[model samples]
Structures are given as structure tokens and as C-alpha cells.
Target: MPDQHSTLRAQRRAETQRLIQAHAVRLFTERGYDATTVTDVAEAAGVSPMTVYRHFPTKEDLVLIDRHGALVAERIAASPAERPLVGRIGGALIDSVAALTGGGHGDDLTADERFLLARLQLMISTPALRAKHLDNHYALQQAIVDALGDDATDPDAAFHVRAAASACLAALHTALVRWAEDDGRTELPELVTKALAAAFGERIVDTPR
Candidate 1:
């Protein structure tokens, strides 16, 4: 009974956080970023202003964090080390996309994809948001580095892994931006795979037997 209650409570908390984030985005879209207040979002979400603040400490975070970055980081960290480094990274990226889109691998953007695209658009349109996004890039890279582990201890392998990670990350960002600009006409997985191939040559697409 206690375990069930804890599970229910956790579920409710997640729901509340999602509710707050959704309302905040709506408010941001309807009103300008500067014009939207925490109180307004709280009212729309049917939660207290403090609750909104607790869920998202800053307005920028409300737009920047969809929790997908953490998901990708977790997936990469959990990925088996025996695979080729780029292959592992690429597979982890695809897994993250699948989880984010609720299991679709098609060209069309899911509802969640659209929501994230809106946030990306918002960030690109606002200078402050763009700066915040850049700041987050390092943290995201660090997460990848941590996931990749002692590859960094050896100078040669360290350089190679860092370069590979950077190329992969750049490929991902390019794919996302291209998808947004094209209005989701192209499949994200295809774009991602293509970008990685271009960046890493044929190795990214090679399958292990």
C-alpha cells in the first residue's frame, strides 16, 4: 500500500510539472516572453505561482528544457561500451528520438516534436534565450563526455572521442534545425543519419554483425 501510494504521488507530481510547462508555453506564445508572468501561467495551469517556479526556476528553462536532453544523456550513459563509439552514440540518439516521439520513426513531427519545435523557435527568436541555449550546450557535451568514460584518459583516444562526440552533437543540431526549417517534411531519423554519415563518413551507418 505504501509503495502504491508513493507511485501515485510520483505520477501526480510528473503530471503537475507537465501541466505547468504546457501552460507556460501557451502563455509565452500568446503573450510575448517578456509579457508572460509566472502568476499568469500558474492561473492557466490551475497551480500556484510557487508551484510553477518550483517546477521551472526560470522562464528560459520553461522553454529550454523538455527533459529530452536528460533522456539522451541517460540513454548514452546506459549504452554498452563494447560497440563502436559512434555507433553507440548514434543508436542512443535514435532511442532518444523514439522515446521523445512516443515510438514513431516517420518523417512527420509528433505533437511532442511540434511542442519542442515551438520552444526552439522561441529560443532562436529571443537573444536571451539563444544565449541560454548556448550555455546549455556545454552541459550537454559534458554529459556525453561522462557517458563515454575513460576514453579521455588516453591522449589519442581522448582526442578522437571528443572529436566524434562534437561531430555527432553538431549533426544532431543540424538535423533538428533543418527539420524545423523544412516544416517537418523530412523524417528526423533520416536527416540525423544523413548528417552523422556526412560528419563521420560511412562508419556511422555501418552495422555490427
Candidate 2:
């Protein structure tokens, strides 16, 4: 019973954190990240400024640390070891996108998904946010390398895994930058799928303009 209660409490805490982040992103998009304040996010989220700080120490964190990246990392870690590493990474990215945006169809996004897309736009367009995102992208690659469980002492394995992770991240970053450039009219999932295919040496029949 105590364990069950603890689980419930943790779940509630996580939900509250998501709520805080979602509201913070919305405010950042609506009012501009520079003009928005933590107090404003707190009020929007119906929490105290201290609580907002507890979840996100800085305004930049509200944009940098996202659940989708963690989910994609977990998917990559869970991929079968026998599979080709780059292909597995690509599949994991698609799976994560489907999970985040309900199949990444882009036909009719849910309210939350729409807001998340908006948040991505804001992050890519804003210089400060873009810098933080690049830092986070490197951190994410390190995380993927760690998840791959390559022996740090084995120079060959370490180099191979690092190279693979770097390429995967590069493809993802390229797709995102292009998507943002097009004003997000193209479905992100489609862009990611195409970019990964090209990265793995598949010929592209249609390129994003």
C-alpha cells in the first residue's frame, strides 16, 4: 500500500512538472521568451514562482529540457543490438515522434501537440534558444553514446559508437533546421524519415525545398 501511494505521488509530481513546462512554453511562444518572466509562467501554470524554479532553474531550461528527447533516447537504448545502429536510431526517432504527436500525421494535431510544435519553432528562431538547443544536442549525443554501453576503454568500440551517434544527431538536426526554415508546413515526422533515409545512403526521390 505504501509503495502504491508513493507511485501515485510520483506520478502526480511528474504531471505537475509537465504542466509547468507546457505552460512555460506557451507563454514563451505567446509573449516571446525574453519578455516572459518566471512569475508569469508560474501564474499561467497556477503554481508559485519557486515551484517553477524547482522544475526549471532558468527560463532557457524550459526550452532546452524536453520530454521528447529523453523518450527518443530511451527508444534508441531499447533497440535490438543485432540491428544496424543507424537504422535502429532512425526507427527509434520515428517511434518517438509517433508517440509524441499521435502518429506524426500532421492532419489534425491535438492541442498539446500543436503547442509543442510552436515551442519548437520558437526555440529554432530565437538565437539564445538556438544556442541552448545546440548545447543540449551535444548532451543528447553523449547520452546516446552512454546508452549504447560501449566500453570506454575500448577505443575502437568507443570511436565507432561515437561516430554513429554523431551522424544520427546530425541528421536529426538537419531535418529540424530545414523544417523550421519551411515554417513547419511539412510534417516533422516526414522530414525526419526522409533525412534518416538519406543519411543511410538511400536515394531521395523528393527533397525539401
lDDT, candidates in the order shown: 0.75, 0.75
The alpha-carbon lDDT assigned to residue 110 of candidate 1 equals 73
Give a tens-digit lDDT track for model 1, residues 88-204. 777677667667654333355677876766676677677878888876776666667677778667778778877777777888888888866776666666777788788777665
What stretches of model 1 exceed 4 Å from their correct place? 1-3, 77-80, 102-108, 150-160
lDDT of 1 at 5: 100
Give all TM-scores, in the order shown: 0.83, 0.86
The TM-score between candidate 2 and the true structure equals: 0.86
lDDT of 2 by residue, 1-209 (tens): 99999999999988988899888888888888899999999999999999888888888888777776687778877877777776766677667766776533254666655766777788887889988887787787777677677533388877887787778778888877776566556777778888888887653212221
The ten-residue window of minimal lDDT in model 2 covers 200-209
